[model samples]
Target: MSWTVDEVMTRQVVTVRPATPYKELVALMSRHAIGALPVVDLVDSDGRLVGMVSGTDLLAKERAAAGARRASRARAEQAKAHAETAGELMTSPVVTARAGDALARAARIMHRARVRHLPVVDATGRLVGILSRGDLLKPYLRSDESIRHEVATEVLGRLMDLPPDAVEVSVDEGLVTLRGELETSSAGDVAVRLASAVEGVVGVRNRLGYRLDASDPRMPPLPGARGLPAAEWGR
Candidate 1:
């Protein structure tokens, strides 16, 4: 499925000014549970996404601050050293992604770039929103497919290392119903194994609780495949 960076991007961004005090940056990250933030020039620039800083970078600064505080140097020297300029540590020219790109492509770019987050930019290169690995992971982990067939095929192919066409599959996410007739009854267990492997799959309500009636269809009297007795199954 296609997704605009804006569609999935985190717009309510937390940011810091280049001159922000070290203690305040630490507080922002801890309180918000955010891994990183955009470092802008002025508080109100709200322009293009510029430099960025991550928790790791902040921790390094914290360590330096602590070391400086503990140094036997003059008290006034320690205070002067404690103040840090954001430009020294911040990564510049924020890595970005286009809003119109496919979700999978976005993820691939992030992986190749080794960046946890990417700012979304428009054609003119102005910051519109920000995309993070967390945003992409959210949809994948919460995926809710509506067809048991689709879910079974996809999940089985992934877990069992089997081709999609090799297995019969069906699924209904709403009501969480799963029903399908496997070519081999033993494969029923295999199907359940596959379903459980998906990140979003909570539980498998397999109607396949019991095995199918494996009957011979070569008999001349039988119409075709035999399930129940003709009367019970309604010929």
Candidate 2:
């Protein structure tokens, strides 16, 4: 069964307001060791999430804003005076999650959208919890031997079209290593790609030998090639 996002979401989410000062925002994020802060504003007497302030966004603006202030005494004092509010720099139309979303799906969304914090909300849109990639990685980072083996086997299954008895999957600690002759170089890539996709497969050592064929079906790693449509390993 797919894992639910809320099952793994970080419950203690740090947030800030739109009107919060830049220095204050930075201090809060730094204190909590967080990359993003949800921007909360009032709506009908209830706190609502209007946007989010992220470390990346703050840095992007700070480089330009800070330079202008350093050039003159007046501007230096004005850094606080005219500092842009979260309303100005924050990303709006927040990307949110439900209590039951699959963790894999949430990771995919986070990856594709380039987001770090995903707030979890109930059906009524009230906030419940938050999720981050770091939180998602924690469990897998601490798994034991049997758990690691099962996970490694699952990852290898996704990566290659293994001949029924050709390849072996083994996981020691958090390492997922693929063993066996791949019959081609591209299969090595397949193994790497698949192993990396799983949540907790930390280090991947490709001991599997790859096969090559210029004229046959087995593929070479052409710069833009993907493991799509199945690259034949030996035949």
Candidate 3:
């Protein structure tokens, strides 16, 4: 089964108003044990995410207050140093994730944006939840039996239309080993790839044998041609 942000994200999120005081923001973050807070604006009873206030943003003020006159500091840092409220110190045009976003996609967004936290929004852009790097790791906690079941039932039985005995799925500590014979090399390759894509799968060991090498152009096509196109198989 595919996991989405809504499944793993924290539904109850602690947010700060744009006018929230800087000291109060720190207190809230400390109490909640969170490194960042979503700066929001209440519009028509909806908490619209406006920006983000992170530990790095708060540190800028501390560094400036300490009289560190480093010329390398950006003008933006200098400005944040003098700010006294969340709106003045927050980073705007924030990167966000949708509630329906896939967990893998949300992980990519977090990695590319270099942020640990993501504010989840609804279709209308209202804050609904929050995701963190810790939440992305929840999938890894799935039992080995569950991963094996999905690889067997979902990937082999349903997607590939393979019979119950067509593929022998074994899982140990999230590692899947597929051992069986298929009609063609393309089918075997697709099976391996699909098994690897299953949630909670650490890796896939492809021990599947095939009757025909569809990838070999010289080989004659099978009667029904269950193999995928060359271009698709290559992928």
List all candidate RMSDs to the true structure.
10.7, 9.5, 4.8
Error of 3 at 58 (Å): 1.0
- Residue-level lDDT of model 1, residues 97-147, one tens digit each, is 888887788888889978888877788766667788878866444446533
Rank candidates by TM-score, best first: 3, 2, 1
List the pairs of residues colliding in candidate 2. Answer: 183-211, 184-210, 184-211
lDDT of 2 by residue, 25-138 (tens): 889888988888888775454777777788866775666556543454343334433447776667778888788988878888888878988888788766678888886776
Tell me the whole-model lDDT of each prediction, alpha carbons only.
Answer: 0.62, 0.69, 0.88
Specify the poorest-scoring 10-residue window by lDDT in model 3.
223-232
Which ten-residue region of model 2 has the weakest summed lDDT? 73-82
As for lDDT, the candidate ahead, 2 or 3, is 3
User: Distance (Å) between predicted and true CA of 223, model 3?
Assistant: 6.4
Any runs in candidate 3 off by more than 4 Å, and if so which?
1-3, 69-73, 103-105, 139-141, 163-170, 177-190, 203-235
lDDT of 3 by residue, 50-106 (tens): 999999889888988887656765787889888999999999999999999999899
Question: What is the RMSD of candidate 2?
Answer: 9.5
Candidate 3, position 143, lDDT: 90
Ranking by lDDT: 3, 2, 1
Two-way lDDT contest, 1 vs 2, winner: 2
Measured with C-alpha atoms, the lDDT of residue 113 in candidate 1 is: 75
